[model samples]
Target: MAGIKQVRNRKLLPDLRKEGHLSKEIVLSTTEKHGVPAGSRLFSHHTLASVRKLSFYHPFSIPEDSLDIILAATYDHSYEHFADKEDLYLQPETRGCETWRRLRNTVGKPPKPKIPLGHPMKRGGITERKSPFSVKLMNSGVHSSQTNPGYSRQPAGGAIFFY
Candidate 1:
């Protein structure tokens, strides 16, 4: 955690430390695939204070729990949230008979291979990391399960996930 700097003056999630575990603020990439529990509560907000404090993107409270379990919301759901919603997935425009897109399909499309680098912005430096394509997102109906994180039994599933 050498280069990590905790954000100050921000309200943490309620009951952040009922147990001994700590909470972290996560930022996922647009091309990444993360899971949220089927019915887990998902929310968004931009407070005057928070907006002022954060420079890049307002904090996205990706739950370490409520959204920990597995779900069936796995459509072509990009890690598409705010902020990069525009830069990563810009819309097309038409002028008279000409229709042009700000991006080319190959800019970030198939046939073009994606390299497996660790989460670059994560606090610690990157080590050779394994792909989480097999993590078992356990079924649950509550926040942080009595079970470990959705990643305990890591290499359990397959690449083709079904709803």
Candidate 2:
């Protein structure tokens, strides 16, 4: 929270780094992926206000139970609002070009890798962090004769099936 004071004073870089109070970033990223659920306490006014102030990028307004439509509207509104504030309307040449460049750079390409976290690796070069390539098993949808549409049930032999 001390860093919030630093940010408010403009002492810290306005650009967001990976570390910090990541709740806003987590919510935004997750909303983009899984969508926001209704009555999410995470979007309560007090929490959202703090997120608005601290977040580097403008957080898009997420609609309850509707992701695509809300995302589109939020995108359009953000573009128009920022365009007006940056005076892209009055000054077409300089202002518009600058705005375009900044926006392009921000959204254009993938960022290069930064330093990895945690201590140096041991002899085998393995760390405690989870690897992306790890193998895993997932539940497959299979139906049993006794089950209904998309319904799963434990069979007599402890096998699960979908109907």
Candidate 3:
């Protein structure tokens, strides 16, 4: 039950430049906990360079026996929503583990069948072709090598133009 801090038009630091993976916005002068019940704001900078240097991962250290956060949402519905809803911060076993790796030594191994198109059925499927038209190039070969009367390519290895 702390006061919220209002931040506006603040510049975010780049990601790669930071040491950790996730770099959330700094909660300046706010008594709010990170990922509080109320939704938090994510910011972006004009330059891609600034974003590249920012961190994308949260730094919360997971206890050796605990799971990691899969989903984080802020909600106001208390009572049932708070009791029945699953906590996004809880990481269940096999959450981040590869499914195939976990099933490696399991029993009742079903024979892997060759999917009609590919191993993953979703990606392999025949689709109707729309265009029956024979492809034709509008431009045949090169136009007259006529150099523009006004402009021409600089002599080979010409002076380098610097910004």
Candidate 4:
């Protein structure tokens, strides 16, 4: 984001000025007030003029009526907790999507568990069958069982096993 800002400040500003979209005095004054850093080769004296022009025409400098119109048209106020009843009522319905409905319905309920409790292992029982893919992989020698000859070792007499 900073890099983009810097490019706008340096490269884009100068280009706009060169195209006569900005004035010479604006360039000189802006550069003088907020001098380009020594390492900023792209943002020269000319870029400063464009920046000054841009600052004068900033969105915040827009009239209150225009700003209000823009805000009313683009800003989403539906999710604001402190929004007035009128504002909430005015918002377009966004509950058609499953995710939006789920979000709206989540109030006061404990969040669902990360791991499903319905799986056989979680229910304190082992699945008797392996997945077909796992069986195929094992038969293809791509996945070997720990009890196979390549991995198996006799337990040492001194080793203590724990359940």
Candidate 5:
């Protein structure tokens, strides 16, 4: 295995700023394979004014994050779900194919797990009055949001970001 190249915000911040993203850290380094994973590279395009991150969506990794990252972790994970673009990067490059598209068609995105509260409706609280209602009364159950374990227990508030 190659040695890790520690990241410095002094350098990373500039790149982020060029891409319209900003960070205030004076230093940044990633020891984990995921953070600065191998095989990643700097990609440039004519349209980009400055550096913009362009990384391949490798096999989807479940990063331990206190909150969702790039709105991805928020995906309903009650069941295994792959991103829409995953198959595109496959060795065969099977983009725009039905095989990948219909993989989960039969089993749609199911609702997240939840505990049905008691009520004639299975929903907590009384409907109209003390009269109970059954699960029939409630079309949905109480649902809660979830986040994976934190990759690191860093204080979110202290971080500085430029708009």
Candidate 6:
């Protein structure tokens, strides 16, 4: 049946006793997943003038019944608040294009094959340059245009034609 103030005061006494003497100001704040409880109160008799005379209170001094209520309310509040925030961040609009772009950039793409200027391969000379595609096509019975005119559908064997 102790009042909130009396309970907090009681909690503070033990901590002060343990320390033997107050030496500094100690701030206490709790962040639970659900949120802070309304019934939970912080009471400190020490003033700023008593900066060297302040001590922290023990959390265990609060009655079990009050602690249970505080924890339940705090857990509920934290869960709701954080869940909403998570939902907001996870929404399609918030994490669609930009996130995808970031991931794509991080993974990177294969580099493009570099074609040198003045190289015979650039001028469609199939005799000197034989690429893997051409070899495969030749192995597959598709004749190169250089070797057979009628069978050549497009530029054969990875040869580039620059007019």
Model 3 TM-score, 2 decimals: 0.17
TM-score of each: 0.11, 0.16, 0.17, 0.19, 0.13, 0.13
Query: Tens-digit lDDT track for model 6 on 77-111?
Result: 44565455334324231343321111111222345
User: lDDT per residue, candidate 2, 55-102, as tens digits?
Assistant: 554444333554443333323444565444323223222333322112
Q: Which lDDT value does model 3 have at 64? A: 52
Count backbone clashes in candidate 4: 2
TM-score of 4: 0.19
lDDT of 6: 0.36
Candidate 4 ranges beyond 4 A from true positions: 1-12, 15-74, 83-163
Q: What C-alpha lDDT, on a 0 to 100 scale, does residue 36 get in candidate 1?
A: 49
Compared with the true structure, the alpha-carbon lDDT of candidate 1 equals 0.33
Off-target runs (Cα >4 Å) in candidate 1 are 12-163
RMSD of each: 29.9, 23.5, 25.4, 17.3, 29.8, 23.6
Flag clash pairs in model 4.
26-49, 27-49
Question: Per-residue alpha-carbon lDDT of model 3 for 125-149, expressed as tens digits?
Answer: 6566656343334553475433435
Model 5 TM-score, all chains together = 0.13
Superposition error at 134 for model 2 (Å) = 53
1 versus 5: better lDDT goes to: 1
**Winner on TM-score (1 vs 5):** 5
Candidate 2 structure, TM-score to reference: 0.16
lDDT tens digits, residue span 1-163, model 5: 1232223332222322211332332323443324454433222111222322233212224335644333432234456466565422342113323221221112223354454674334457655654354323435445521222343333677543433
Better of 1 and 2 by TM-score: 2
Segments in model 6 whose C-alpha atoms lie over 4 Å from true places: 1-85, 91-96, 99-107, 110-122, 126-163
Error of 1 at 89 (Å): 54
